[model samples]
Target: MSKIIFVNLPVSDLNASMAFYEALGFENNPQFTDDTAACMVWSEAIFVMLLTHDKWKTFTNRPISPITTSEVMLCLSCESREIVDELNDTAEENGGTADINPKQDHGFMYNRNLADLDGHVWEMMWMDPAAMTN
Candidate 1:
């Protein structure tokens, strides 16, 4: 068996959040989606569960984090620097805020950060495979 990750996020608006993720290349799994939550798949092993405030509260009593404050930053690796840029751009086009942090670029690696409609931070990055050998 292989391990899989399900990142659960509390969203103010489920539909909007789902759309935002869809623009960033995530596919909604209707099998697990409902009025209160949505299952967004990033890859075969990576999934994001977008839950409404009420649904989120059921899981944890903790208060929801403010959009201005980041509890965590999720990072996604891209095939190339171009793909990283494309995802960032797509996010911005779909109600997300792009370049929340300054862009980072090294000869072998490149990264950019974007914030979703609910202010969840997602870092898009690309690294040269050849550089990994060094």
Candidate 2:
């Protein structure tokens, strides 16, 4: 069986986080969702579990990071530069903070960063397939 990835993030507001992710095109899996947690499906192999702070502590004793701090940066690839920009815009429109870092365009690749309402950094990028061969 292929290995699947499930990234669990602690959210202050489960309903808001679920709405934010939905704006970015992720589908919610109701089968795995409830009041304290929401299962957002990025793909068949990738899922993000957004858990309320109370439920999150059940799995770990570590304190949740502050809103201004970042524990990790999650990056997702887009099919084109336009798509990257579109996602960034959607994120911003839906309460995510966009342009946290300077935009990058290296001829072969383009990327931008945004922070979710809970301050999780997410990088959106696009790369030219042709560049991989060279």
Summarize candidate 1's per-residue lDDT along 1-134 as a digit string, tens digits: 69999999999999999989988989999999999999999999999999999999999999999999998999989999999999889989999999999999987899999999999999999998687644
| RMSD vs true structure, all candidates | 1.1, 1.2
What's the lDDT for all of these models? Answer: 0.94, 0.93
Scanning candidate 2 in windows of ten residues, the lowest lDDT window is 125-134
The alpha-carbon lDDT assigned to residue 32 of candidate 1 equals 96
Position 45, candidate 1: lDDT: 93
| Model 2 spans with C-alpha error above 4 angstroms | 132-134
Task: Estimate TM-scores for all models.
Answer: 0.96, 0.95
Question: Candidate 1 clash total?
Answer: 0
Residue 106 error, candidate 1, Å: 1.0
> Which digits, one per residue and each the tens of the lDDT, describe model 2 over residues 49-117?
999999999999999989999879888888899989998899899999998889999889999999888
Residue 43 in model 1: lDDT: 94
